[model samples]
Target: MKKSKRAITPEDLTKIEVLSEPQFTKDGTSYTFVSTKINENNEYEANIHLQQLHEEKSTPWTYGKYNNSNLSFSPDGRQVVFQSNRSGTPQLWIMHTNGGEARQLTTFKHGASNPHWSPDGKYIIFTASLHEDDDVASQKELSKEEKQQLTEAKSQEPLVVSTLKYKSDAEGFHDDKKTQLVSYSLEGNTFTQLTKGDYHHLFQDISPNGKQILFTANLSDNADYELTNDLYLLDLHSNEIKKLNERSGYHQRAVFSPSGEKIACLGHEYDYAGATLTELYIFDLQSGERLCISNEWDLQLGDYIIGDMRLGASENGPVWSKDGEKIFFIATDRGSTGLYQVDLESNLEILHKNDSHVFGFSYHKETDKFIIGISSPTNPGDFYLFERGSELRQLTTTNKEFLQEVFIATPEELEVTTEDDWKIQGWLLKPYGFEEGKKYPFVLEIHGGPHMSYGQSFFHEMQLLAAKGYVVLYTNPRGSHGYGQEFVNACRSDYGGKDYEDLMAAVDYALDNYSFIDEDRLGVTGGSYGGFMTNWIVGHTNRFKAAVTQRSISNWLSFYGVSDIGYFFTKWELGHNLMEDPKKLWDFSPLKYAENIETPLLILHGEKDFRCPIEQGEQLFITLKHLRKEVEFVRFPDANHELSRSGNPKLRIARLEHICRWFEKYL
Candidate 1:
């Protein structure tokens, strides 16, 4: 039997298309979203538009030299407010719903984001961290005693602390840094601080009556607010605050039902024995009764545990129908994040099923329609409008034009069964100009989180690799989310064991099935956990010709003492402290296997990254260099762990280009 081949051409990689962020109005007949149209001047301009149903197009809202999305429509659908970086940092901007004179509402140096219009449409509230204390110099004033207290709290084992959902990345063991809840009145530019405190407030939801504010914070009685956070309510009238959940476990994503009598949210209040899987729960405000919403209690959901608010995972954060009869949300128990509707009267039922996952959504009360944002492993981010018995309409496609203009090869979804009979999901983006019988270089791209999933989304770096003529294969291994809880926790206390086998199996599957992939030209790359795996792969085998490790963990022992989440992450994932099991941590360190690495390697890191920290990368690079092996290191200054996402846009492009350049040079 002969083998079949897959190939593509350079001409297929440059067909760019244009689209916008889809925002539907209350009437359901019209929708609006942000779009960047390529002008004759060869630059992009941000525009807003309203398109009527069944119409090809209707209206365009034009501003100058900038692009914006994350639109929030008023309750009456008369005004829209969104965040824009047009003035440099992101600030809140407002424009009439029908499109008129656009006005800037916020003018802060540090910028403002996540603007949410009050239910009554009288004011707008959002998260702002622009105070002078966020500055580096101001933060350097912590006295020795304060520093000792912070360090001691962080090092304390089984430490007693208040709050439910605790421990944010980089914040360490103190809750001194806070995100202010600022509200801007529509009539006047006056901004008021609703709830003043020295704790973080995120994912705020106003009560149906607009008389109270519900949000998640870590401001319990404890001075060591570095622990978990819980949901709280602030009465706009009496100015009294009340705690909602009584459990010691993590509780977040709280929202009031349309009737205002009950609150629905998602939480993991019980201990999974240090596992990262969180399920959905609903709490009744009046009676203090709580119920688990999702039947898939063990199913892992969302991307990262940091701010894993259920708002994006669920159809709408405990959103109620206009009549308050049902709730809609996205569930991952079925293997993919599909939108599901739960009836308060009946059992939860699947409403809309798609291969892609749902992220964010907004409801239009007047028309009973909902706007949803969806993403898949193959597709980037796209918006869709879903109404009962109506065909789903794609509202905005921000990258379709760019993707088309680049005309890179689309990934082919692939699934492989592991040694344990675990069916793993993956995709392969074949190289451009590929020919069936001819072999080409292959790059095995790994994802971070160890708990994250690589779904269908337009990734610039991966696409650029395909454009540069290399087959890129990325997969969700054993510990990745989207799979149920057991699968997510599969890597717990066994980091480099089964997970490594899963990745190796994926590489083997690609090599065996793809006739055009050259085994001698194999390469590997990843960030965070992916970076750790990349390090692991090079140490364990010389099959790969080249490797790139970004923000990876080289030594678990050092990582525990250094990383912001080092204390909790190591203990939770490895089930051991350095003192309790130093050998276990060292045995898993990629630097421990430096002698086995025969491949050329590149080390990439962000100087300001506090998560994995740059030292981890330094350890690996130094080890490889001291051994007189092929190694190079690149660091981006003023960059953090999120250098790839939400980092400086220009630098992100540079990072992508540099990685491809490295692969082109060595692979």
Candidate 2:
């Protein structure tokens, strides 16, 4: 792994990169971010950069191959608006905070997005999607071959179904446009619409005397069976709006408070459904009252650490503290994600605890100085420089020359305990060029949000399965999220039971406290719910001498009629619902023990995975090739279920070369 540093190539996924939205600059002495990577046409680009706390490199303020990203900065920070898909899809542009040529602001036709400004910058605000009877100043912009003949004349009409939140593995079948809230008017350059129609608002925060605007919707006229999210607010000088949580719950990111008379948010209510635990509140706008300010906090606030080098959006929060009596945020606990604060009498503090993965932040509020962005497990992230009486300083080693040319590995934490006495935290790694008494071949690796969390970030497919020599591990077990809210609702209605006994007690405590782990060369893998726990661990134990799985499921009664959130994520993680529970969702599915799989699996999926949908990998590759076994499948095509996170970068390097050639052909 390191005679001269090498291992870590799936084409280094276009040379690693990522950084993210950070911001700061209303005289906080400059800052901006974005970065992202993978492009020599393996797509995904992202740009913006900036920096200047007396800089040491960080300049590219928006360059080519599109993806500029939601920027902002205006109130006397002299201009910069962002959100680009360069002339094609995402719109709003505006430039010049000390540089130039960016122009174009809003040429509608269902484009534009999250711009924001107004603190008297003569208003900007943004967000687009219209069609429930259009009209953001009559939605114009067309020609790109008339927007491909109006999307081939609206895909030849005839499609009308109602909605159970009409399909979304990030936009696939929902099309009544929704997502409103506009405004533009940089001194009447015109474009008004501020909130309208059939639900979907989202934007959040604009107040500090910009006369109100924070958002979140669910305008419940049965907002498609009320999957809650309320919080509203609106006013920008009397367009009056109001409604701020009488609580149903699933409140959202909110903000507004450096004396805008209170706001701060992040919500929850679904007690343990979707594995609940999100909390943090505080409301008040002239006496609406509220206050559950992390009611005795139990962690789980933001960044649910699942990596694949991020793509733009950060600044999770409650945010205030410019003497608004403290607020700040970013939570998840025992397996990383730090920076926290609490104050309006609740008193909490931490402000950057370690074991990394901070994910994004900016805050300066007159010298409390933060910047943030962290990530670790040997760095796939940077941007540091905190300050509270000094020292947390690192500004950007943006992967220091791709870490002096590769070889990462690290991990090692582990823990273990579980046959219900509980413990389970995890890490492991070891293989890359290791020597200490040979053995090796271990794998494991699970993470796919059984409520997301396999922490200490930076996981290039667990460093390409510990540089292909294996022994990787991973863990967080019981429905994950940094373990709280009763162990993340202890594996919901027990699918594959108690996160399969905390992943076979961390693989029997990594095969009895690791003696270089061979334990019969055990390899396993995972993807969505770690591909349904590698198809329920090769259909209930064959002690994995190689399995793969990827966008899996292997049945849950046709994943309650073809998953796009499988009809309420199988009654919020299998408590039962396809008419109360068809044989307990086919006795906890993995294709009901695919005729007791004898392990040599492989599967992998994502042919536009609408949340585990390549017919759940063609029904486990045609029932393990009709019981002949030793399966094989693959697929990928226009990828989804975030094909190994943020899909399509050469199919995420052909999904890590098909999970490292199916664990180097059976470990």
Candidate 3:
């Protein structure tokens, strides 16, 4: 008899290592990345790791309690620059490739981040938050005492807001601080403010010749009312600025061509509002001609795939090949993310495709290879080396030991046809050590971003649910990204119409196909949009024995006024503003149909969640109680909308435990 492996526990998350942000050297001989894990203090601990193409082992370049990330290699590849919070605030730090003590570079009051090396490697460009009253001239003239007084005056707790977009979920209450572009010269050991204004400037990339820098900013007089971010170019020497794209749209991550003749960017015209698929575009520097390169590629460019992992990962670059004839980027398709290549001739191809999530990837032009960070149903995430014809080699074994000691369940890929003839993609995770004849309770999980898709990524919560002897099912409904524009836009205005049908169709397909699932023992749960759906499901049907809703929305009427992105999100998704049509908003609200709900409900919300807000949960809980329905509300102190993914480690574990306990009591 063989020793049985133990089921994965919530505590096992602390041992899981997540690797991302791969940066390759100019020569493509070596690369560096960040490896992050939860520390004993219940905080994320990230360090830089380096590996050579010819070597089989990877070594840690930096280690400490403080988080270090955004690794970038200097042009010469002799020094590495990264952002670290070891100094109490995030600042730029430089270390040798050979390994030694890292030297601190910037000591600004507000700190610096997003460091970009100039082509010549003589200067480092970065963005820093500066007070509204502070500027290069004012800072130089101010005495030490005056600076201290100004800092104290700005620190007062009172938040005076006059703009509609005054608060954000990530930054909290908006202050006077504005993010501005600045450059630091290594030769002179001096700093120069590049762009300044009341607007926020996001650094994109440096031109190949290093003569101009490309960035994006609103720069409009009434930025609060506008929903566009225009691309701009600034002359490094003359300080002259020029707008690259004249169209009114949101443009970001623009990279100049190797020859400095054109630029490629990721953005959309916003014709579909928030549900619009991101398209790729190329702009000619000389002729000022803009072409939508990916207009025909129905797929959404960049990563919108979601999992239970910590915030998944940020989007990678729209990197250009050395020859400038082709550009390589990431695209979310069906249930997976893949690397795609496109040419000027409108030719597009998927360079690498897998039934897994490619969260982050880097292309090494010189070596014609790739350093990709990927995750699947069983694997958390690791770095892999890929070439044209050679076999893909695993670069880092960050979680190999822990995986060998635990039992990991693999999800079975599924495809269900809806009553409307639309195909829905999904996955089913069987309980660990699943016996043939034993029927198990099933839980249907829904993803948050009604726009984001559930894919081939490792989800701790789903796996944990399966470990507790429940089969877990999740799917990409009509509005999911991996499909196409029509499928993604199908849910708009119809909220619970076809999208609801697609989810129910998925459940029907699962019950008919998977014999191990018990029909009577079914539960449903979700957060954000999924949370809204969970509420809708209970109100419309009694098939589910129990349901858990996390950071969800119950009322669109209140959501438009309370949520962070409510003002625009409600109109974008519901296709109706509160004042324009209150009846339409009320009809789509889940709270309006709460009287019909019969399934026991558990509501989980973060007190500090600005996106969905705790009020959404409160309204639902109060309504259910008024109707004498079985319901419970769990509120997490000091947590936000990201509580489940990137909240306090203890709180995340507690939330998971609560979900499991609630389902066990009913299912």
Candidate 4:
């Protein structure tokens, strides 16, 4: 090992600064972004920073232990409004551009978020969750003692369930509180509730003329069974609501043009359910016509590059040119994301495309420049200044000091041909402190989101494993995004079929090509869908000496009713529901092959993970123990499905240490 460099440790996450939510002022003279860091208390503290185009370093505009984000500049660019949790919940707060103490703007019981300024800057458009009986201005935050008393009283009351979607992993249990739009007037200092009822009005954008508002929600009579998020436009003057689409598809991320004459949309018709590729669309208000702008494009719109360092970075999606002739957006293509522009005639051209993850982007036509956030295998993330013709100059090096002290691994792209003649893409990292010729242990990592791809983004877990002397391998198999639409939908209804072969083929190709890989000492691990794959791998073969499955699914029968989205997700992905084809789901379940599992298995799960409940790990543990097989189980309290990505800082460290300890013991 070199004298100046040290291997990365789990605590290095505290030193890493996660930068996201990039935005430019109207004049393009200055920009603002959020930088998040883990404090000594093991909690996330994010603050907004401002920097001019020629400035060397950014100045912190806000500071505290509270989480601050969702910043928006007023029409005059003299004031900025943002949402903060300083008052125990997220509420709108505004401060002058010159910098001073920020003033709290809202005290609603449930708080306000996603603040946006109207064109005239008279009112700020935001959303807040409210029950039908709660008044927007009168229902305020309760005292600590009152909250405790209310909690005690409500604990004894039965949670009455009537809706099909009664719970969420984020919110825990069902309540009457639904998201609604409220306009806070800066001059009048009054709260005006724009929409209300049992549904949610997801605020998308306010018209450039300040007369209209665009949002999406399902107001259908049978909304319990409907999955559509139909686009709607609300006239602020008349308070009238109008639906834009025929209510056939799930549409969102809609924005109005600079002229306020039309709107751009990103959505899909649920052809492959959630696995369907997102297409772009345009709506003309003058002609009352709609056009699909990206009908011929096979790529998925928006950023899909998976990473762990992102925290509420603003991505300006479907931005129209100042003249309203073209729209700019980001798309994932072949394991990388890039910026692209499309005209009204469907002619598209790439503005920036490369082998890097463009996690966040902003465009300024006034100055013909853009600010983009890029990350690679070795870098965490940093913002860049890019003019149309000038070179992409680095603007911020948030991880410069951290990188100087720690060694970051650079992944080599792996190409493997599957059994079906299909190509699989992956990356391989060499173990730290390498010699000229030495065989080393290898560990394969599978990413969550059977739909989310493993791409050119920074992953702290993989880097830690490589630093600990194990060659790490991660891949994007079938059913992963960033490939074309058909490629992403290939693994549906055949979960353990071709996808398993693709992974095994990739491993075999890796072993054959890399002489430094020790064939006898192989370990495997994955989370969520990757967790299911890990379980399936152990049951199907004894090749891997050790295996770790995290937040996995053991039996689809129980998952069909237990998971938050299990009812429809099972049928959509597996082509079967609980009652219709229990046999098929059972056949594909890894628990069915428990008797064949010879590898030492480690099951890791979170107690609060509603998406993949802890019962999954329990089922596998009991089945394996009953069969006299080697097994272990680890359950994290109060952690959810996102435990690995955004869980409590201490628990995230513990999780990583457990993975390293297990692999070190066996591999």
Q: State which candidate has the highest lDDT.
A: 4
lDDT per residue for candidate 4 within 1-667, as digits (tens), equals 4536799998887888999888998799889999998998999998999988898899999998979999999988999999999888789999999778999999988789999999999999999999898888786876668778888999999999999999878778878889999999988899999998899889999999899999999998899887889999999999999999974889988999989999999998898997999999899999989999888989989888776666665684898888899999999988898889999999999888779988888888787788999988889889999877778989998899889988888899988988778989999998888655899999999887799988898999989999999888998899999889898999899888899998998889889999999999999999999999999999999999989899999888899999998998899889999899999999989999999999999899999999998999999999999888988899999999988888898988988888888998888
- State which candidate, 2 or 4, has the greater TM-score: 4
Report the candidate with higher lDDT, 2 versus 4.
4
Clashes of 3: 0
Q: For model 2, how does the per-residue alpha-carbon lDDT over 1-667 read when each residue is reduced to its tens digit? A: 4447878878887888888888888888768888988878788889988888777788898888988888888888888888887887788889888887889878888788888888878888888888877777767777689989877987999668777777777777887888888888877688888888888898888887887798998887887876788888988778888888885888887887887888888888887878888888888888889888777777788889887777677887768878898888888888898988888888888877778889878888888788888889888888877888778877788878988988788888978887658888999988778888888889887888788888898888788788878888888888888778888888888878878878988899889888888888898888888889889878888878888888888888887778877877888888887898699888888887899999888887878888878988898889889999998898978787877668888888887898899788888
* Candidate 3 wrongly placed segments (more than 4 Å): 1-3, 135-157, 310-315
TM-score of each model, paired residue for residue? 0.83, 0.33, 0.96, 0.98
* Candidate 1 lDDT tens digits, 257-336: 88888887767754644455676667787788877766644555443321101111223455677787777665564335
Please report the TM-score between candidate 4 and the true structure: 0.98
Evaluated at residue 330, the lDDT of candidate 2 is 86
Tell me the alpha-carbon RMSD of every candidate: 7.1, 23.0, 2.7, 1.2
- Over 205-284, each residue of candidate 3 has an lDDT whose tens digit, in order, gives 99999999999999999898888999999998899999888778999989999999999999998988888999899999
Ranking by lDDT: 4, 3, 2, 1
Clash pairs (backbone) in predicted model 4: 21-313, 21-314
Candidate 4 regions exceeding 4 Å error are: 1-4
Local error of candidate 1 at residue 52 (angstroms): 3.0
